[model samples]
Target: MKKDKFLFLLSKKLSNDISVEENELLTLAINTSDEYKQLADKLTKYFNQRKAKNSKTDKLRAAWTMIAKAEEENFEGTFDYAAPKSKFNIFSFLKIAAVLILALASTLVVYTLQKRSQQEIQSFNTGTTKSFKLLADGTKIWLNKNSELSYNSSFGKEKREISLQGEAYFDVVKNSAIPLFIHVGNITIEVKGTAFNVNAYSGKPYIQVALIRGLIQVSHTSDPENRILLKPNQKLIIPKALVQGNTSKFDIEPISTLDLLNETKWTSDTLIFRKEKLKDLAIRLEKKYELKIEIQSAQLKERRFSGTFTTETIKQALDGLKLSYPLTYTISNKLVIIKD
Candidate 1:
């Protein structure tokens, strides 16, 4: 089916007036057709949203009205009830009904399409590793290595909200009216236009939010009563203990503002570390390269390393680690094994 025609049929389906046969036809059409996948996805989002907001009766009535309008506008004078030759066959009736339904359904169909254009605003993990750019308003977010970010299509009007798992750097466009909000694990960071880095891996013990510029407010999404206001060059650490309710709030300790420059060096395609521990460094390297790294000895994990690594292959990262500690690493495919 043509894009326009598929959209028309989708509108009829939404209207509750589609016959059982028509519904089956639409299912088959959408299933076998790749050209109409975009249209089908949009229709699915619209129907899901409508179902979320309206009661069953209201939805049914709205659909009935849509079908009635389509029938009236498309088949008005075309049908000759008294002419024997003009009497409708099943195929003729279906064709005429489709045309009329499509014409009447255009307005609603357009509205649904527009609303769902950004419906894929949230992309989940596709197993291995993937990267995507989120064009928010004028601000552009280059989602780092293994992270995922999601938001509703209708964001930024009331409150700009996004959920993050893993790490991402934000170059937020200055907008005072709508403050950008990021929810990672239990913590929420609110900011306007600012540049910042967030490391909030799900498996990790702590969530870290570092601000390079502008003011941001960080708080626990679950415990709204607790909050922390961060200034430029400030870093907030929500240790696993604190996040698990072992403590009420994260510790208020100031990290060297210089660390912000190193932490975000990945944005420039470089990995820089200053006096970071081997274990901590491994966590970052895993996320950066999307590989699994394991340290065999507990003693080896605590050794601190400090160096600046340019964008190099995983071998270079391992070599950099070897230079800092008396450890040997074996690489097999995507897995890195460390032995001492």
Candidate 2:
């Protein structure tokens, strides 16, 4: 059915003037049209703002009168459902009340969909192994251990957006009209077409975004006016100090081809490190192995190690770490204790 016709039916449904046959049609149409929901949401916000400012005894009645005037002027006899301009009388109040009901009904639809949108979010948490997700938009994501990603099941209809925590690699489908938006910590990454890796563990000290291909635009929550465009092979970092209200800026860095590999290698179950602090590496190891690792020696935690280990058990990986430094570890139950 045409959108205007659907709106016409919707108007009748809200005003309690719809016939039994029309009520069935309205239910089916509304249940099927996400566009109608989006439009209703916009109108709900508009009415909410106006209602907040107005001091009229009958705010909806007054608001509808103003809306009828504006909409009639804009449509100029084009809209079939346009309410006629009549004085505010008891009889006219009934007619205006119907119009007001239609508007209020739209607000109700918007509110209901918003609550449903919140409930429709698909969430996944990765455990010791990496997990994969194929979004409704055909975007593929690799969620590393201790990470999570969530998006509405209705994604890509009105908007393409997602929420992320910990770390994940996104291979987004290209759609210039509907760019993908990812919220990582206090920053948002906008992409039309890109393959990127993001590290945004809440307990970590920094949020890192590394783009392997295509372009990406990043903006921080505090400094949204300034958008930083990341070209191919570039990495962007937002320190936790900035994410937690300690600072107010982004930290951008240029990444080489090799560094890009190092950043995203974990998606393949490979732990790659180049001069990473043992303390930081321990955190990564704990996440990947799902074990509690405690560094008993503060001196050993400060030391840096560089290596890559794939297809190795946690014990084997730690034994490899023993080769680099004078460190010893013992695994009991699920905890691994490392000491000088």
Candidate 3:
């Protein structure tokens, strides 16, 4: 059906004047097309807002006046409002006109909302601490510092999907009929009731996913034919090359118990590093402490260190690193510089 016809049916549905057949048609349209679903949501929000602002009769009158004036002026030549001839019911003509006016009002509101609202739910962890969220579908997510996750308002209805910006740990509820999809850059992770940790920080050279349990499928967005199914205790690492290219050439290895613990310890506000390079470690430090870290010497940047930090100050964490290696760091203001 055309968009205008669907809108007309939607307006009738909202007004509780739609026939059973018309309601079925609208339901089918909503289920079949994402565009229709979004339109319905916008219109529903608009009607609810109107109800909150004014009485029912006043809201209806205002909507009818506004739409009738606009249509009489802009669509004057299209609709015939003349007195009906024989066999033409005047009351039916008036009822159809009212429904068309309602649809026009809904269209105006939808257009206004589209112009102003981005229509996505965004959860961003901009502070020095991690954040947690429980989705409407009973899925739990833990977002690390300086991370972001976003999904459209229509999420979890027919399919579950979200986009990730940095890092997160997800314990998804199982629903085979509606598997979850997580998009990170050019790679997509398909999960069906799995607990996994994803590290896709923008400054990093690679994106990593460690599945603690259940199953997941990872694929390059441009090359779906090149994919990998990851089993429990498996980790998939995609370098920048594979992410930007058309192939899914990446590394898939088994994750040890300790490895899983280190990967997910950040969810508990604990930072754990195992033989991590100084340069890579600086990125985590910067995010956790909201500071700027600069490694001065090339040798110092390549130095490896291992440690676990929980409830430790930035100075203390760096001091512990110095104990493991011959390094000196100077902290001034919000900046930290490291050297040999």
What's the TM-score of each model vs. the native? 0.45, 0.45, 0.46
RMSD of 3: 20.0
Top-scoring candidate (lDDT):
3
Quote the positional error of residue 210 for candidate 1 in Å. 0.9
User: Which one wins by TM-score: 1 or 3?
Assistant: 3
Per candidate, the number of residue pairs that clash is 1, 0, 0
What would you estimate as the lDDT of candidate 1?
0.67
Residues 1-340 of candidate 1 have per-residue lDDT tens digits of: 3445556667667654466545554654554332254456765676567666667536545555555576778757776768676355554455456446544545576556556654546454423333334343545464566677777554554457788888888878777998888888777788888888888877888888888888888877786657778887778788756644334567655668677788787676545565577889898889888899998989888876654443568998788566545689899988999878
lDDT of 2 by residue, 1-340 (tens): 4545666676665444578656545544443334454554565465567565656525655655666676568856565665786565654575666666665666576566666665476677876766666554557687888887777756766678899988999889899889998998777889998899999988989888988999998886676666788888788888766733333466777888888899988777656565689999999898888889999987888987765655579999988777666688899988999998
Q: Local distance difference test, per candidate?
A: 0.67, 0.73, 0.77
Name every residue pair that clashes in candidate 2: none
* Residue 229, candidate 2: C-alpha displacement in angstroms: 0.8
Looking at model 3, how many pairs of residues clash? 0
Q: Distance (Å) between predicted and true CA of 296, model 1?
A: 53
What candidate 2 gets wrong by more than 4 Å, as runs, is 1-119, 243-248, 269-340
For model 1, what is the alpha-carbon lDDT of residue 78? 70
- C-alpha RMSD for every candidate: 18.3, 22.1, 20.0
Winner of 1 and 2 under lDDT: 2
